[model samples]
Target: MSAPAPIPDRHGRAGRNRPGSRVWLFAVPGMTLFAAFWLLPMLRLVGVGASGPSGAMAYLAVVTNRHYLWSLVSTLLLSAAVTVVTLAISSLVGLFLQRNRFPGKSLLLAMLTFPLAFPGVVVGFMVIMLAGRQGLIGALTDKLFGESLVFAYSLAGLFLGYLYFSIPRVILTVIAAAEKLDPALEEAARSLGANPLRVFFDIVVPALTPALISSGAICFATSIGAFGTAFTLATNIDVLPMAIYNEFTSYANFAMAASLSIVLGIITWIALALARSLSGNSVPATA
Candidate 1:
């Protein structure tokens, strides 16, 4: 039998050799940075927790510890609450912005996105000033309601503080999706005898699902890993991040902290995976 002929080059060697074809070169630097800073550290963390003859046993003990479990539960609950609240408020705001033209709409949009530019620490401080007992709103509410609605150093306070930072992120994500939507879709549904409420449920809301999932995942991840906000808003509230911080810094338990950090990383990764899966299956009502 004759030897098999060499495979023909696709796109020709010339095309492959073009200067722009070296785009992969640009990715090298980013990949190098990511591998060094993020990927390597994450691997080291997981490795340290799961390595050695006793490492698995040690990690199991940490994971099964009642205190650690409680901290994880509290963090998840708080993150979920923040995610839901952010989604609700952002969806409404995004829908309003998409459907209406208002005076100072541009200014409002700018202000809404302004929080993204601030450091998390600064945002936490702002929340404390606005909602703490001595703050204006807190004082005013106390005077009117005869009860102090102090938000600082409490779980409720932490939730509200997270909301202040998270809502803006959700709004931006949802609004981008909303802008891509065709208003005519809703109008056509109304013309077809669907009521406004039915049209919203049947058409508008479904179109926003992908955006909502994306935003919720982001908010969930941010809330779970938040350090500055938790530190400032509720030092007494022990969440997973706080637990990890204490284990590493206060108790000097590097192994335990690394184990907890790995757990948090895995949880965030699972959330992101779920979001991607949901987004992949979601169909835009506009189309």
Candidate 2:
């Protein structure tokens, strides 16, 4: 048999390049961007962290210093609380909205998700308006018990604000995931004598685990790094972000600020990393 004709250069001259070279070509821009934006900044941050009065051990102050350590702990706890509460509320609302039909359902959903449009500061202000000293709750309590129920400048207010801001995004994620769940699986579970709770835990929860992991990670990261809401409502609390701000702005301690920032970033990274490892998917570094 005659030799087959040479294959046509369907992918063009560039396509004739080696696979490794092609990969480098495609990857160079992204790698360059990553280095410029992410890697360089992180390295500089590390350097700054080490440039403190204590030298390279400056980052240790995040744990060694009582105030800084407490701030870090409080931040982690708040972020975890926000993640759990947001997941719980979002899951319920998402499921109900997805499975049930009622009057003005669209309107209700739109209203529920309207918080997504508001910034963190706006959410804090809303919290203040609802629970601040002169807010509705305060007025009601004062009217009923002769005591104002003010909490808008404390950790409680920060919690409420974070929850409010986190719920909308999480609800959207849960709703999207809920819509894709197979009703047949739920039905099959019921057919097999599984009760509502059983079916939910066995079928629905498993199916939605990935979404929950991803969204919870995002919520945690957001809460960890959130500055605006904390700035607006953290009179009694010392969250890490606010601590970093105080260090950098109020105390003019660039080294402490950089160290705190690195510590904060490391904690956030660990949370996302764990979620990704468990969920087998990519998670965003920042919310």
Candidate 3:
């Protein structure tokens, strides 16, 4: 019998190339990009973090030092608050927007989600314009209460800025999740005499839980590392990002800043990882 002929590739070559060679060819670009952009930076950051006077223990400053610890804790708490509030408000608004149709429905949705087009710095500026010393709220309070109420340079302002950006992101996710929900399940629950709240909690909430968890993780991660907003309104706030900024710039404490950054990245990564594992899917997190 004659030997079997070799298979031809798309170019009509006589013989097949190694399968692993094709795989590597397909993967090399991505691997190179990852190494260049992600792996290398991470390694450098780790090395920098460990190069401090405290050496490898520099990372412990996040918990050991008073200011660093407070900043880290405050950032986590603020991010958690933003995540919870964003999920709650977005869930309601997204479901309402999805279920109802009105004359200005499209316009309303555009307005609600318009913030997604704005960066964190812009969001922070908007927050300042709304709550700054000369802002509308301050003016109104000045007229009504004989004193201007300004919060644009404090934690309240940071919270508002975070909430502003977070809402649009979460609402988009919630709307997408809501659109995929099975209407029949809600109808079935209603037919059984389940109240609106009961149906929502039992049917709707469960259905959207995965999306919520995933989006909430993303929101937390984004808020944790949010620099622009914190920078814009950190007069009295002490979020980790602001702290890191101060360390790197004002104090020239590069090692401490690197350590803090590593800690922050680790926390955010763990949150994203847990969400992915729980949801059994990838969730895109904003930096």
The backbone clash count of each candidate, in order, is: 0, 0, 0
lDDT of 2 by residue, 1-287 (tens): 98544443656433333435456688889999999999999999999989888887778888898999999999989889889999999999999999999999999999998988988889889998999988999999999999999999998899999999899899999999999999999999899999999999999999999999999999999999999999988778799999999989999999999999988888889988999888877655796
| Structure candidate 1, residue pairs in collision | none
Model 1, TM vs. native:
0.85
Model 3 Cα RMSD, Å? Answer: 4.9
lDDT of 3 by residue, 1-287 (tens): 98666777779888754445556688889999999999999999999989988898888777989989989889999999999999999999999998898999999989998988888788888988999987899999999999999999898899999999889888889999999999999999999999999999999999999999999999999999999988877778899998888999999888999999999999999999999888868656789
TM-score of each: 0.85, 0.90, 0.91
**Runs with alpha carbons beyond 4 Å of true place in candidate 3:** 1-21, 282-287
Q: How does each model score on lDDT?
A: 0.84, 0.90, 0.90
**Which residue runs of candidate 1 sit more than 4 Å off their true CA positions?**
1-26, 51-54, 141-147, 281-287
Best-to-worst ranking by TM-score: 3, 2, 1
| lDDT for each residue of candidate 1 in 1-287, tens digit (9 for 90 to 100) | 98554443574433223445668999999999999999999888888777745676656765588999889999999999999989999999988886789899999999988888877678778877887768777888888998877767778778877888899888888878988888899889989999989988899789889889988998999999999888776556889888898888998777888888888988999998899789875455694
Q: Between candidates 1 and 2, name the one with more favorable TM-score.
A: 2
| Ten-residue stretch with the least lDDT total in model 2 | 12-21
